[model samples]
Target: MFGIGIPELIVILVIALLIFGPNKLPEIAKSIGKAFADFKKAADDVKSSIEHEITKIEEEGKKTEVDATAPAKGAVEDKEIKK
Candidate 1:
């Protein structure tokens, strides 16, 4: 997948077979697959946590903005009533 074509893959697999032997190859592949899966899961969890924090911060900001303007609006209404 990383730019290695079929021939390259075959050569690499042959080398692995020579070095690691067929008995250990499947176990290694399984371990590698599990590691990648765990990594992906951790990344997704962090992404979701960050998104939740951002959403909470945005909501708090909107609430603060509305609260800040409310007092001014009330002051304006009071002046209009006096006039």
Candidate 2:
């Protein structure tokens, strides 16, 4: 993906083969995958936390709007009476 062609993949594999050798390659790949998985999990957690906060704020806003409008509706009649 990300513009990585077959040649690039082959080069990467050769580098890995040289550095880690064949025996430890599986362990190294597993560790790299686990690291990416952990990063995704953390990102998802933060996204959910932010979404929950936005929902809470939206609910509060609706309650406040209803409360504010109720008083205004009642006060409209009171103003007419005073006039």
Best-fitting candidate, measured by TM-score?
Answer: 2
Candidate 1, RMSD to the unseen true structure: 2.5
lDDT of each: 0.93, 0.94
- What would the TM-score be for candidate 2 when compared with the true structure? 0.83
Residue lDDT tens for model 1, 1-83: 89999999999999999999999999999999999999999999999999999999999999999998777643666667888
Off by over 4 Å in 1: 72-83
Which ten residues in a row are the worst by lDDT in model 2?
Answer: 70-79
**Model 2: colliding residue pairs:** none
Tell how far residue 13 is off in model 1, in angstroms: 1.3
Error of 1 at 30 (Å): 0.3
Off by over 4 Å in 2: 72-83
Note the residue pairs that clash in candidate 1: none
Candidate 1 similarity to native, TM-score: 0.81
